[model samples]
Target: MITVKVPLQEAERAKQELMRQGYFLSGYSVQKEGDHLYFPVKERFDSPYAFEERALEARPEQPQGLRETLKGKLPADVLGRLKTAYDQVGDIAILEIDDKFKGYDATIGKALLDTNPKLRTVLAKATGHEGAYRTQHMRLLAGEDKRVAVHKENGVSLIVDVEAVYFSARLSTERKRIMERVQPGERVLVMFSGCGPYTCTLAKNTEAEEVVGVEINPRGHELAEENSKLNELTNVKNYKGDVREIVPELGEFDRILMPLPRSAETFLDVALGASHQGTIIHFYSFLHEDDYAQADTWIQGVCDRAGRRFELLGSVKCGQQAPRVFRWCTDVKIL
Candidate 1:
């Protein structure tokens, strides 16, 4: 598919024309590239740069009753099962369910599409998760992609134009990917595990003997349990309570995922003293790339206070945050 970048006015005009005709808008992205604004569209595979080029060759005229293609029908039984939690936006269908889900799967996404015999090639399941369905009507995410399952990330997923939200760092996908570096067969202590993303991912993806996930929030605790079941991860446990009181009592661990980005550095003492030789303490922060050396100095200072040394394991780009603010995680091995 051709990814074309155009101006906003052009994009709106193109979008209207595409809908007025019979063409489907596959991908839509309006982004800021340095000083220029761009609207990117994914072109039809067999078409020219303009969708009209393809329309010219195949149908001479814009086909009749194009909106009929969108109001595609699904089975009554399916709609009955989905309840009234679904809202249709043009060709896209969205389902909103209040869930602290156990794990992610396709069976959970039975509402993204309906078997529609109305179009030549049904364009269902195109609009995945969006940001509008957040709990308490708090606008957190743009929306959940309907086609992409968070657990099915072993495969391809949709792309989203993410925005900054208050306390949204706790929900970042970087928190999930960096946890992949954790070695197997290690007892992990994940403080502030949120919804157990790191805990369950570690358990299900590794051969860990035990993973103790701790969260203080009651709703988070319930969501963690649900996430544990969703991923079907074994050898993992979720403890619902503040970790400051609970962590010291849990004894020692070979690894720790200190994920509370704002104060992850403050927990360094607990991580160092609680760790044995070769233990890795994964820490995330809002520091700039140049500040990594400063972060290392600070971490090593904690190591020195604890009568130990640490080996810096470097950092990587998690995702983009706001203007000039990016989130990154650095690993250090305890000596």
Candidate 2:
């Protein structure tokens, strides 16, 4: 159930009547807009009549603002708006946060705080921006699916839906796992760079000479740039095109990340097209619970064709998408 604070002239009497109908409210306050009342809304109403009566009795439209009515925010709407702002310019990132933590509930800027007559005398400076650019409605797409999250060094948030966490969970150890290992004076190539998470992540952590990432989808490309800026990774450059074309122009790099799980095998030509004899082609592929040997065979075949050998560096159980089986990772070093 969500709580909404409504204003009422006869709040005491209304509270008594509402309690008789299994509804109870006890908070009261007033503002320039008018006297406001606080009420608790049930998670579910018995029938349309129950909902209708509550709205009629409270009249939510009369409130000073509609912010009090929101609860259990949806993630899609914010993600959609983020894509828009990011596409127009790569510097902006969508600040995804709990709806309960937004609006006046959000970190009130000093300007708004200064207007409070009591506060004006206590402070000198009063100003800041959180950069959250959406209002209205919230919901969550929840289920048994795997989860993944992205964050950069620039105090920017990059949340992405990983196909499977068993493989993607590497994100949690950003400071230790991958980001911390990269040194200065290196060139890195990130393919299938969705939202530029890994690309930006590596760039932020490494003192590398250059960091290049390519994403096929427009939304992902836009996010990649935004994420790059979020991490304040000035050296990271993103190509808003397919990796097949972008990889060739990049020439050679010390390390190459082949992150596309669906058909990473097919893109071997592209990886080899830009890679040298000792370049490590980090790849991801989906396999059955017992297909480890088959997966190894597949990797061997890929290595042989390019006249190179592969050494399995690590494997991670990212998370589960199925009841019996889970997502897995195979980090191979190609030489």
Candidate 3:
């Protein structure tokens, strides 16, 4: 094998240059000697580093992802239909399988468990989010029978009941984004806070004076309180009730978060009512790409009803809800 011999200090830079010029070979481990390194290459060209013929060990094969693990186990047609994207909440894997691949749930789940040794449970979405709580039904396809899982993100531990409460690990980045924007001594409110993912994340990561969360679902509220205690957060409070009923009584806030994407517009009046001058509100909604301006319109309408002047601070695309539709957060500042 052809190898480029360079000092340990220059090895990284030299290796990058070699790879960029199509000289470095793949699937081989670099060899190290006293104060020197040998990177395998396809062919030797004139260089500052010395060239030598030396045998090198092959690198270990990369671990297979979920789809790669299920390739041979599932039929070609079914495998093509399977979406590899899954939500991993703690040791639980939440999957969404198309109805056409109905009977293969167990097999798919087993393959997932086999591929991921850390996973203790595999659940398939039995139904879409339903009812007032927006909780979805999940079927146990493999592993443990329980639905409870401890999901940790942004330096906080959240105990979530996947079947009883709505939670999304996908929004961890969004939660962190909101947390970073929180100012010191600011009081933050999270409406429709499910299992305290956003509430706990903000309380744990930010310098906010206090963080209050309101959840209508009993299970979600219970877990939110539990999560606050679990993280040993002293500046956190969880309320079990509708935001419309609870937010007004909590008084004014420095910042407010409305995470209910499906119908967050319905509660904009409540959010605006609980805001004071210069208060920043992160209002989330599901809207198509072309109609994203509708979110700003909703905010304007609510501000008009409340007789409060406001400034639109722009929007963020949190995640995709459909092909062309996205979960958007429209940031607004009360004036």
What's the TM-score of every candidate structure? Answer: 0.54, 0.50, 0.82
Q: What lDDT score is found at residue 3 in candidate 2?
A: 40
Compose the digit string of candidate 3's lDDT tens values, residues 1-335.
98988877555445534643457676788899999999888886756568899989998744345677787889998888788667878789888888778789889899889866878999999999999998899888899998998876667788999989998877766787887799999999999988899888888888989999999999899899889899999999999998888888999999999999999999999988898999999999999999999999998888888788999898989888999999999999999
**Evaluation by lDDT, superior candidate among 2 and 3:** 3
Question: Per model, how many backbone clashes are there?
Answer: 15, 13, 0
Ranking by lDDT: 3, 1, 2
What candidate 1 gets wrong by more than 4 Å, as runs, is 1-179
Give per-residue lDDT, candidate 3, residue 2. Answer: 89
Judging by lDDT against the true structure, name the best candidate.
3
What TM-score quantifies how close candidate 2 is to the native fold? 0.50
Q: Considering every candidate listed, which one attains the maximal TM-score? A: 3
**lDDT pick, better of 1 and 2:** 1
